[model samples]
Target: MAGGLTRYRHLSRSSSHRQALLRNLVTSLVKHEAIHTTWPKAKEAQRLAEKLITLAKRNNETARRKAQGILYTPNLLMSKLFGELRERYAERPGGYTRVLRTEPKDTYSQAPSALLEFVDSPKDVRFVMTAAAVARDLAEGREHTEITQKNVGKVTRYRAGGKGAFEDMVEKVRALDL
Candidate 1:
């Protein structure tokens, strides 16, 4: 018998186990900033990577442990997650990782992949601050400083000759228009 054998340790796992495994793997990848694995593994890793990044948007213990629970290796990942990744992904709203195929000329290369490189561009906040300012201004009773444009659609009458309040008003307005 094979002593201490762990054949197919990463693969051949149950669906739930596989999902958890991939989630942990990708979570660690995001925490550490980079990771390498088989092409198919990388695909699964991307899924987890995006999820972890989304979680990173909210830096909290619950989110951290949620990510940790899904991961197989938590120490290395935890360090990178709380230290580098937490700050690096602060301003990014979502969409954390990108997968790129590595090998372009070989058969194995047919399934190659890589993740989107991290960049430190915190100034690029994905929020429309002006919109919020406008809302605040409106709430404060400030008049709209700019002309508002609107697309007025064609009006159709459902009960034109009926004795409804709207129909009565329409008749009055039509009579006035004449």
Candidate 2:
């Protein structure tokens, strides 16, 4: 009889039910940066979080309200999601989320699930190293303490001896005039 009720009711009628739903989604998203969940729930979370991230990126009053309305999250969580998430994904375009299939778990409900992950593009390490090197050169007026072959972590000396015949051949090569 509820004509416009387009909500996906997961069969619970209490506020606790709804809160638990949101908490589980957020926790899983944070813990693994992804989760294997039902299609409907996964889609809903992806849409909601992406909208929140977009709003956070704008960083204004209207956007703030939009984010607050999207997820029933607290002020602290909302702050982290908005501030830190905005900075983390600043240079990226859309399609920032990914959902993938994984092994099935034997749960009460027989529905299969998929893992959803945030697809952060790889940063250029070479460019980062070059920037760091430039900064060190500027501050110190020289290369920052050139690491000799010894001070760097564990060093493995490469020797040309293995078995008995290999050692004999190496001695013969060492004694060669040519």
Candidate 3:
């Protein structure tokens, strides 16, 4: 089985159960714009979330119905999904979700945890972190490093007025704890 092609993670669940679990995770992702879970679960859910956003972008009745099937409590989230989220990603092609790995969330299970979020949404931590890094570099009179510049580019690439928004965040971060 080593180095073989695998279509998707089974997550040690039966097919129906796996579908339901991913559906619930995707629903929560839509409602909160972010979630923390085991890295495997996050990656699986990221795939579902990305496809769902693509459906929203399509903006058709059939797509709406398909989206409804995937999203629990579709009535509450559909408008936001088809409206706000659709507009948010209107210009971009793909890769709407970002998953960042972290240390184990709890000591017992010791499972690797990750944060999954839509890239340009209000809950984007990378954007905030980039601003903090920039502000810290400025405070220390250091230049922005290559990694920081790369992060800056990624966080700002598809966001509306992203450069201005990041500049504003840098100022806010600079003003704090300085």
Using TM-score as the measure, the top candidate is 3
**Would you list the clashing residue pairs of candidate 3?**
none
Off by over 4 Å in 1: 1-13, 104-178
Candidate 1 lands at a TM-score of 0.47
Q: How are the candidates ranked when ordered by lDDT, highest leading?
A: 3, 2, 1
Predicted candidate 2 versus true structure: per-residue lDDT over 36-139, tens digit per residue: 78655676567655665677788888987866665544564667666666766676665556565545554677666665655441232222233344344444
Per-residue error for 1 in candidate 3, Å, reads: 7.1
What tens-digit string does per-residue lDDT give for candidate 3 at 24-112? 99999999999999999999999999999999999999999999999989999999999999999999999999999988999999999
Model 1: per-residue lDDT, tens digit, 85-153? Answer: 766666556655545455533465464544333332221111112233334444567764542111001
lDDT of 3 at 35: 94
Q: After superposition, how far is residue 43 of candidate 1 from its true place, in Å?
A: 2.7
Q: Lowest-lDDT window of 10 residues in candidate 1? A: 148-157
Query: Local error of candidate 3 at 133, Å?
Result: 0.8
TM-scores of the models, in the order given:
0.47, 0.50, 0.96
In model 1, what lDDT does residue 142 have? 75
Model 3 worst lDDT window (10 residues): 169-178
Query: Which stretches of candidate 2 lie above 4 Å from their native place?
Result: 1-32, 121-178
